[model samples]
Each structure stands twice: as C-alpha cells, then as structure tokens.
Target: MFTPPPSPFPSKSSELSELEMTHDTPTHANPSAFPTHSCQSKQKYTLALRWTIILVPITLIAIGVSTRLFIHPTSFDALSPNSIHEWKTWSKSLTDWSLHERHKPTENSPWLAIVPGTNASPVIKRSTLSATPAPTVPINPTLPTPFPQPYDTTLSPNFSTTSCYNFFLNMTQTDALRSCRPFSLLLTRSQAFIQNQDDINATNIDIWGTCNTDLSSSQCDLNMAWFTSSLRSSCATDLSNQNAMAVSALIGLQAFDLMRQAACSVDPVANAYCYVEAVASSDASSYYFYQLPLGQALPQITSGACNSCTKSLMSMYSAALSSANATSLTGLQATYGDAATKLNNVCGSPYAQTSTVASSSAPPSVDLTSVGGTWAVLLAVGVLSTSMSS
Candidate 1:
C-alpha cells in the first residue's frame, strides 16, 4: 500500500507503558523469572490434599485392624492365666472322678426282686447295693403277730420242710439288694421300643378285658375307646414322633420273624392287623431317618452336672449317623426340634439355652474334615491384595 512515510516508532515511554499493561493482564506474564505467591499457595494445597487422602485411609485401616485384634478370641487376654489355671484344676478333678467311677463295680445287676411290702424293686447283681436304704424298724418277738402264722411242719427231727417260695424268700437274707434303677444309656430308643410292647399289651387288656383275643370280639372294640382314652390321659407325652420312630425301627427289624405269627394269629384285630402289615412291608431303610440326635439333641445342657461320657458317646453316634446331604440334614434338624425341646425342658436354662456358636467353637479338626475353608479364604485375600497392588 502506498502510504505516507511510516509513522515514527512509538515513544519509549509508550512502549514501556504498553509492556507494563500487558504484563498486568493474566496470560501475558512470564512464569519463569518469578512465580506468583498464589501459584505457590495452590501447589501447597495440592500437596496437602494428596497427603490427606493417603493419611485418612491409613488411619481408618489402622483403626479397623486394631479393633479386630482387640475383640478376636485369638487375642492374648481372652483366656487369662487365672482362667486357664481354673480350667486345668476343674478338668483334673473331672478326670480323677471319672477314674474312680470306672474302678467301682455296678451294685445292682444279675437278679431283680419286686417286694410289695416296701414298694421297692431291687435289682441285685452279684450281691451289691447301689443306693442308700431307709431306716428299718427292729423286729420285736415280744409283740403279737398282726397276721396268722402257718403251722410249723417238721418232716424229721433233723430236717424241716420249706416251700420253694419260702426258700427263695430266705435267699434275700444273705443277698445285698441293688438300689439304682436300670436304664439304657445310649440304647434308650431300643429300650423304649420294648416298653412300647408292654404298653400295647396294657392297651389290649383295657379294651378287651384281656390281650388273649382279637378286638373283633363284641367287648374288644368297646374297650378300644377306653384304652385310647387311657393312653391319651397317661401317655400323651410319650406318643411323639421320636418314640414312634424308635418303635417303628424295632418293628421293622423284627418283621421277618413275626410276620407268620402275626398273620396266623387266631383272632387278629384291626390294629394288630395293621401293625403286622406295616412290619412285614417295612425295609431296613425304613429306620434310616435323615434327622439324627447329633449336636443339639444330646448336648450337655446342665451346668450343675459334670461332663457325661454317655452324652458325648450319643452325640458322636448321632453325628456319625447324620445324613451328608444338606436337604436331608435340614429335614432331620427340623424333626428333632420336638425332642430337642423336651431335652431343653429336662435340662432347664440357663444351661438349656445353649448357643450353636459354642458348638462351633471347637476346632475344625474336631469335625473330622480334612479340608477346611480357612486356607481358601487366606488364598483369596492374597490374590485380591496382589491385584490391588498391581
């Protein structure tokens, strides 16, 4: 462009002023020579934020870890020295008592006698008494006899005649009567099953006025109602699924031998007929129930009593018999609820109110399992840590 002579360059003052204005405006300033104070402040703030993020997470993690260590059972203070010493002493006492009991002989066994006079049934085995006896009154020959006496009959000068019953009666003079009652320890179900037979006989007597004939007889059916009513009144508590299962199992076992007798009986009644058919049809597996006594049904629910060998044996036995399948276990657990409840009633609380957690407190090896999940959990945590670190 044809222009007049180029305008003179801006004066130095104007140029300097323009440069100062440009520097004042943001983005036009140089950062190398002197950084602004605000920039330093921002840098410090960013560093502080980074430090806070790192420190807060570390503190939280430390607190969480400390809390776990404080409350866990593996912590040092859980089983203190005094508690440990007390436990040891208690355990030793139990062991000594057990040894002493083992060495002692069973006082009542071998022979059983029922004497109507004292309302006492003494079972004597090898002439020993297991229980204490009530005080006995001294016999007074001076006092007149309350009842008539039999005439003394002497066969000969040196010999006397005594009946067999009298001879047996005299035997008690030399023998020590057993005082403790005999009961099945782990074999309660089997024993109770036998008792059920006696109950049935009693039922039969009440219904038909005797157990010798079938209920088809005129009076037999009439007695059935009374028999059932008596059973309801006296044994309503005993006629539970637990008792039924035990009885059924025994009956199923005896089916092979009793089928013919049951079928050929002269006067088989409706109930007897049903029982016979059930026995004949049942298989060995019929007794194989899914729910077993195991951990809950037979645990030590009483605090007052020492550790029981019988209970431990029953628990182990039941556990061995338990089904492996979860579904079966669940069903069996449910079915045992009633029996468990009865047991709880027998062993009143706070002992009866046992926690399943206590049962789980035993080592994993106690369950007789080779592979526990603890190792698997540790391995999983290790892999997670490695991935997170990477």
Candidate 2:
C-alpha cells in the first residue's frame, strides 16, 4: 500500500514548478498594500490643502483688523497738545512774513518820528484823508490815521477772495511793504501789542465789539463773551479808537495763530471750528488792512492758510472712520468722544452750541468709498479661497 502511494506522488521538480505557478498566477498573488496606504495619504493631503486655503486669508485679515484697531492713531492722539512744541516751531516758520525784513522799523529808522505834541513812535504816512473822520483821531501826526469816511463795519467788502501766495514768490521786502501798506495799522498794532500788553485789550476792539446787525442783543453779548475769552487780557472798558483798532488787529492775528495751530490738530470737530475761526480772522485782517491807503501793488489777502489743510484733515477723518472695521469702531468712537469732551472743556459754550447745531443739522459724514474698499478686499479674499478650494 505504501509503494502504491509513492508511485502516485509528484516528483520534487514538479512540486517546485507547481509552487512557482501559484506565485505567478493572479488569483493567488498578494494584493499591493502600498497602493491602499498611498490613496489614504493622498486623500488626507487634499483635505488639509483645502482647509489651509480657507483659513490663511481669514487669519491674515484678522491680524490686519487687529493692527488697525490697536495701532492706528486716534483723533485725540492726533490732536493732543503733547506735540505742541512741534506745532509751535512749524507755526513760527509758517507765519514768518518776509516783509518784516525790509519794512520793520529800527531805533535809527526814519519810520520812527515824533508828532508835534506826542511821543515818538513808528508811523506810515497816508496819502489821502477821508471825508468823515473816525470816532477817535490820532494825536501823533506820524502815525497812519484811520479813514475819515464811515466805512462799512462789516468785514464782507474788505475780505480778499484772491490768494496772496504769489506775492511772496520773488518779492522784495520793499515791494512787500508797499503792497502790504493797506495792513500797516494791523502790523503796527500787532508789534505794539507784542511789546506792551498794557496798550490794548483784544476783546474791546471795534472789529470784534461792533455787533452784527443780524444778531440779537443776547446773541451779540454771547459772541462778545466768547471773543473775550480768547483774548490775552480781560475785556477793557476804556479803549480809545486808536487803542481799539490796535486791539482788533492783535486779536485777529491771535485768532489766526490759534486756527493755524488747530489746523495741525487731529480732532475733526475742533478742526472744523478752527477752520471757521481762521477764515473769520482772515476776513477781519483783510477788512481792516484794506481800509488803509493803497500804498503799492501788494497781493490780495484771501482766507487763512489752513483752508487746504482743514479740507485734507476732514477728508482723512471721514475716510479713517469709514474704513474702520467693526473691531475698531469702539476705539474710534471713544477717541472722538474724548476729543469732543476736551473741545467742550477748552472752547466752552461756543463749541457746545456750534457742535450741537452741526450735529442736529447735517451730522458727521462717512466716506463710503473707504468702507467699500474694505469690503472689496474681504470679498476678493473670499472669492480667491473659493476658487482654490474648488
């Protein structure tokens, strides 16, 4: 029985051939494990890539928003008086008149002379006398006398709408003095006030004291009080016409300086008021200056130098507020509130009234363009992320 089993069994070579065939045949072959693992890894990589595309832009946007909210300067920061020293230096340069070099009088200058009964002072002679004399006459024959005619008390006609920027270009001091002679009284008064504060009270001057025809007595009184508060000294009851004119000129100049400083400030509301005051001061200066005899071809004085600056600042303010993201809105509001409070404290009832009127009438405007730009950026990022993920 054992011999029969051996005969039936295959040889060793045949067994080897059978094993090789089993290894090569598709049915018995082992499945490739690497392919399944590679496929799984590829799927994971694709999912991670899609998520990264969606998250990167959002993260970057969040960082940018945070930066604007926390890092950008607020209105209060921009308008803070901490930088007043820089502003003072800038103002000195901005207001320096080239005419002073040639026209300003020295002790030995011929412009200094004695009137018959009055003490010696700097003076500029007038070419003509008005038909009607001013309320007060100059005791000194050398001083430029006020117009004798009953000129319009309102500052409308005298304000120069034309810009005087060209006058300073290639202008000689002599030419400046000749052209600016209309403002001789103003210049003289400013110089005198600087030298001796006792000579004038800025509030009692004719230019400021003359109540507007449109204003009621109470309104006029309120205006007078506001003007008085801005003066270097308390309002004076005993101002002569000459002294009043000097005081008026001094006040106008001071107001101009204040507006200039405010133009450099960051507060929107304060900037607006300062711009208005600047324009008013310029009008007053020009009105009084033009009253003098036309000495030479000086450039026509226009509104204050802060006009362009004010517009620029207001535009910036609107743009910043409008562009501010939701995250930054609270901070910006707080900044504006602080600035408003400070302005109310400094400017008192005048600021309160004007701000109230402004707020009630037109309210603050936002720059839609800036807001749209922010939205456009976010939209673009979203679109890009969608496209990449798809």
| Residue 147 accuracy (lDDT) in model 1 | 16
**Candidate 1 wrong stretches, greater than 4 Å:** 1-26, 36-41, 53-390
C-alpha root-mean-square deviation, candidate 2: 26.8
lDDT for 91 (candidate 2) = 53
- In terms of TM-score, how similar is model 2 to the real structure? 0.16
Ten residues in sequence with the least summed lDDT for candidate 2: 289-298
> Per-residue alpha-carbon lDDT of model 2 for 269-308, expressed as tens digits?
4332232233234122212222111111112233332233
- Candidate 1 to truth, TM: 0.16
Candidate 1: tens digits of C-alpha lDDT, residues 135-154: 11122223222111111122
Clashing pairs in 2: 132-148, 179-298
Q: After superposition, how far is residue 144 of candidate 1 from its true place, in Å?
A: 65
Candidate 2 regions exceeding 4 Å error are: 1-342, 350-359, 366-380
